[model samples]
Target: MFVNKAYRFRLYPNKKQEVLIAKTIGCSRFVFNRFLSLWNESYQTTGKGLSFNFCSSQLTQLKKELEWLKEVDSHALQSSLKNLADSFDRYFKKQNEAPRFKNKRNNVQSYTTNIEKKNQNPEVSIAENRLKLPKLGWIRFANCREVKGRILNATIRKSPSGRYFVSLLVETEVKEIPKTASTVGIDVGLKDFAILSNGKVYKNPKFFRALEEKLAKAQRILSRRQRLAIQQKRPLSEAKNVQKQRIKVARIHEQVVHARTNYLQKISTEIIKNHDIIGIEDLQVSNMIKNRKLAKAISEVSWSEFRTMLEYKAKWYGRQVIAVDPRHTSQKCHSCGHTAKENRQTQAAFICVSCGHSENADINASRNIHELAILL
Candidate 1:
């Protein structure tokens, strides 16, 4: 079956390429913001925003008038306009909040450019450790895996920790695996990352908490540097010591993110490969986070990220993932269908008052989720 997928890799650009990339990112952001302003002005004055075609046509004039804009990839500029248009469309549909202007200080820089298909030349290709883009030419990247199929577009981004990455969107086909009879349910928690219906538990790595002390120390040093800079009447951005400490703090957070992502990817792949049908709670994480007491633990566990990984991996592996209602999964007795506050004897134990049944709380929840999935 055909599947649209994205593969991301770290980029190692030379000094000249880095300059060009920075220019391209800046120009893309400028074009997007400028057009957004025009769109708003037109909407207020004429009750309608500029059409995509109209915006593109104006961009041609803009590039001609602004010589610096001509130095970057023209396709990237156009893509910026398309992104703004798409964002506004989503806003109108109430699917997302309105788009905001991109700020350089935000510490996240990115631009998207599409690969053109021509009769004589392919727009994108990979050779060894190099990747060819529209205007950037061959740039070195860590080729962790071979990219297959037609390349549609790519988004290049620079993180706060001064790392560059490129996400390549590709159109490819994947063969579905043979059906398996095995099925399982999962209950996610803070003590353990996940508890399976079959009584297996995946321990929470707690990456952030593990690095919290180091992070706090780095931040404290950064704060001291900032205070010194302020006393000297200089902007924090211009303070050398402050900048160095900021990077130190950022790297710690980056490590945490990488560790969590790696763990989720590994566990999700294992679950998808082992089971044909996977059931999980349909957790309202946003509402759940409102409870300030549990928010930190919830965020650290990264349940949303885990669920997202499971869903996408399930599709790729030819497995089924079902979201069961979370209402009484923890409180309900799996053996007798009795559900009440008294059923949960403690955080870790469940003893059904009506049926006198006993089980691990998380395991019981997983069993209830499994039954719900089977019914669904």
Candidate 2:
């Protein structure tokens, strides 16, 4: 099976190289926005959309027109154009969703270059790490993870902190493990993200809560400087301060994201390894958030991220995951198959009205999930 994996590489460049990196990232964003504008215009006027190749040719024409465009390397420019075209292709494939206009935001985009076809191996030496592009010269990145499979593409990016990193996508074959005999079910909640059927309760790390105060402080500082800058007719000092504030906020956000991602990775790896078939409740986050009492706690969680982790890790481990309707997972008595609204009293205890069976509320729900999975 082909798996999508990302490997990060650290970059150390001189002042001149840093400028080039900034320009390259900016140029790529410009190209993406320019192409998006053309695409929407074409759709509005001719009622016929352009293909990836056609959009790419337009970018090449525009590149030739700009004097400073020559400063960026040629291959990099072409790669940027290609990446934009691919973005459109993927967007249009999900035509039901409305495509948003590309903004000049930091994440507006980074740059991508095909690595697998050009480089025989990712473990290439630093001397060979240099990648040539349209206006950019040979840029090199030291090896990190062993490029076990052919690299599909590598993206070059300048993070909000003004740091640069490259993310690599590789294609490789993995053997599926023989079927395992164990199965498990998990019930997720606000306090503990999940409670397993075997009476194991996993607490919710609440990644967002840990960073909430810091983010709030950063936002306040950002707003103060932003307001002053607007009032002062865009003072350079204010502009610089605002940029600093934005980076501070972005750093905290990134840390929280990494922590959450790490937690989910650990949980998913455990779930996939020991279980052949896993069952979980299909939670409607939006609907569940209506409870004003728990909204603060609910907002801190990333249940959807957890679900995604389970899905991909399960695939990696040659296991399967099934999400069943969450209708009575909490109220239903696993022992007697009795579901009653009154069975749940407070947040901790579940007492079956019909069977008089009592259990820890979340644990009972998880047990019910396991029971339902075994039935299937």
Candidate 3:
């Protein structure tokens, strides 16, 4: 089956290339913000937003008037317009909030450029340790893995930690793995990342909590630097110390994210490979996090990210991932089909009053989820 996948790599550009990258990001941001303003104005006057075709046609004229816009990659600017259009589309569909103006001071900045194929040869290709871009030419990047499939586009991003990375989106064929004929249900919790119907538990690593103290210390120093910059009547960006400390704090957060992502990837892959039908709770995490006491714990568990990984990986491996209604999963008795608040005597244990059956709380929940998936 054909699938779209993204391969991300660390980029190490030369001083000139870095400057050009910064320029491209700035130009892209400028185009998006400018077009967004026009879209808002058009909507206000005519009760209709500017269409992609109209905005795209106007971009040519805009570049002509703003000579600096012509300095960066034109494809990047067009991509920026496309992204703005997508944002509006999502907003109108009530899938996201309304599009907002891009700020230059944002911690993370990115620009996407389309890949052109000439005589069946793609302009964007990885050669040895370098990647070819539109106007930036070949730039060095960490060649950690072989990039397969046809390259569609490349997105260059600068992280808050002041690190440059590139994400290449490609279309490729993925062969499904051999079916294992195993079915499993997973219940995710703060204590354990997941508990399978087979009574197996994947412990939550708590990556953020592990590094919270260190991150807090770094952030405290950064806060002091920011206050010092303000006291001196200087912009935080202009203060070298503030910038350095900011990067340090960003790096700590980055480390936590990387660690959590790595763990989730491994676990998701294992589950996908072992089970033909995987059942999981359909958790409304956004609403769950509204409880201030559980917000940090829920965020640290990263259930959404884990579920996303499982779903995409399942599709790639020809496995079915079913999300069952989470309501009463923990409180319901797996053996007797009894569901009541009293059934959940404790956080870790469940005892059905109807049949006097007992089981681990998460295990009972997973079994209920498994049965629900079978019914579906």
Candidate with top lDDT is: 3
Whole-model lDDT values for every prediction: 0.92, 0.75, 0.92
- For residues 1-376, write the lDDT of model 3, one tens digit per residue: 9999999999999999999999999999999999999999999999999989999999999888999999999999999989999998999899999988989888899999988665777778678999888899999999999888888899999999989999999898999999888999999999998999998899998999899999999989999989989999998879999989988999999999999998999999999999999999999999999999999999999899999999999999899999999999998899988889999999998989999998899999999999998888
lDDT (tens digit, per residue) of candidate 1 on 1-376: 7788899999999998899999999999999999999998999999998889999999989888999999998889989999999999999999999889889888789999987666657778899999998788999999999898778899999988888999999888887777768999999999999999999999998999999999999999999999899999999888889888898998999999999999999999888888999999999899999999999999888899999999987888789999988998999999999999999989999999998999899999998999999999
Error of 3 at 6 (Å): 0.4
- For model 2, how does the per-residue alpha-carbon lDDT over 1-376 read when each residue is reduced to its tens digit? 8777777775666678878777776676676667777878898999966677887677668867986776765556667666656666777788445445545564524677654445344432234555443234456666554666656666777776666777767677766777769888998888888888877777888888878998999999999989988988996454988988888988888788779888888888887887898899888888877999987777667788888889987887689898888898898998899888999986998888898998799989888888777777
lDDT of 1 at 44: 97
| Model 1, runs deviating above 4 Å | none
In terms of TM-score, the best-performing candidate is 1
Arranged by TM-score, best first:
1, 3, 2
RMSD in Å for all candidates: 1.2, 3.3, 1.4
For model 2, state the Cα shift of residue 179 in Å.
4.5
How well does model 1 score by local distance difference test? 0.92
